[model samples]
Target: MPHTNPASPILQLRGAQVAYGQIQAVKGVDLDLFAGELVSLIGANGAGKTTTLNAIAGTLQLSGGSMSYGGDSIAGLPAHKRLRAGIALVPEGRGIFTRLTVEENLRMGAYTRKDKAEIEADMQRVYELLPRVKERLQQVAGTLSGGEQQMVAIGRALLSRPKLLLLDEPSMGLAPLIVEKIFEVIHTVMKQGVTVLLVEQNANLALGYSNRAYVMDGGKITISGSGQELLHDPKVREAYLGEIA
Candidate 1:
């Protein structure tokens, strides 16, 4: 079930904007992510999807508007601070350290944590969740296939034990079967109580997996609805689903 807590939102952004000098990538966006719900933000290239996620992840500063997490303003918090506050981002292109072993990369995820025993336990849990990761613990991250690298990236993020997981393009550049496996792992994570904000180009898959979704165009959100509603919407079908009608 989707998170029904009416008292507070896990993450909220109002009038959120980001500009790179004269180029405004994300312009005056308003969004809310509730606990225990999988939300997708979908759009074509240059539609500001990545910019919005970067703002939420604290990698980019917002030029306008307010952002809050768990009802407290976190506008000035650094990226590491946000991680400590239970927000973890699995960035696009699987940004794992190519030189590091899978085990070493996973350990990097818990760098901010001081609980040795708990971190160890979490590592074991991740291994169980992704058996392929466990089998290649000593392998260099760069040596793995695209799908394996993705698995390691996700497992590393899970070690942080985040309340909200920001996934940017997990399905990019993978074979169809690989994409399905990645989505399956994501679904498992969601069921395990991680609120996910997924940014995907695969509209059909994103809408199918998410509870609710937002459509972006020209740096602004143009549509918002339940996943099923958007999936069947005529405009969405034409623009995102590649329907001729």
Candidate 2:
């Protein structure tokens, strides 16, 4: 369930914009994410969903507008600084280090933290959540299957102990069962008090898990509603859910 009480948003964006040379990817977008809510940004390919996530993660700089996290302006923060500030991004394509072992990959997420004991406890939690990743701990990450790699990618992000998790296309290029498993992990993460901002291509799945959702078209947000509201919306159904109106 979404948080209903009035509280400051964990993250807020006002008129946020991004560009690639002259090509504007995200245009004047405003978004808010409250603590402990699962929010989804859904759209077709090239609709600027990924760009929005990147901008929030500090991987890409905004050409215009303002962004704040935890009530503090962070438009000028760098990617590593954002990560250290409890914002972790599981970027598109997993972004795992191919040559590293699974354990090494997971360890990389905790690089910013110096707390050894807490890190080990978090690693145990990840193993419990993803037993397959534990089984592949000694194996090279490059040799893992797509599903396993995705697990590793998620587990690595978890090890960061982030307050906000930015997931970009986490369901991409995976089997149905794998996608289900990935969403399960996301649900568990949300239950554990981590706020999630998901950019997903699967509208039905994304909305099913989201507390609220936004629809983006051609670099602009066209609709916003509760997950259930959007799921039943005629326009949303016709445009994104493959349903005839």
The best candidate by TM-score is: 2
What are the per-residue Cα lDDT tens digits for candidate 2 across 1-245? Answer: 55553899989999999999999999999999999999999999999999999999998999999999999999978999999999999999999999999999999999998999999999999999999999999999999998899899999999999999999989999999899999999999999999999999999999999999999999999999899999999999999999999
The per-residue C-alpha lDDT of model 2 at residue 221 equals 96
Model 1 off-target regions past 4 Å?
1-5
Query: Which stretches in model 2 have alpha-carbon errors above 4 Å?
Result: none
* Global CA lDDT computed for model 2: 0.94
Candidate 1 structure quality by residue, lDDT tens digits, 88-169: 9999998989999999999999988999999999999998889999999999999999999999999999988999999999
What C-alpha lDDT does candidate 1 achieve relative to the native structure? Answer: 0.92
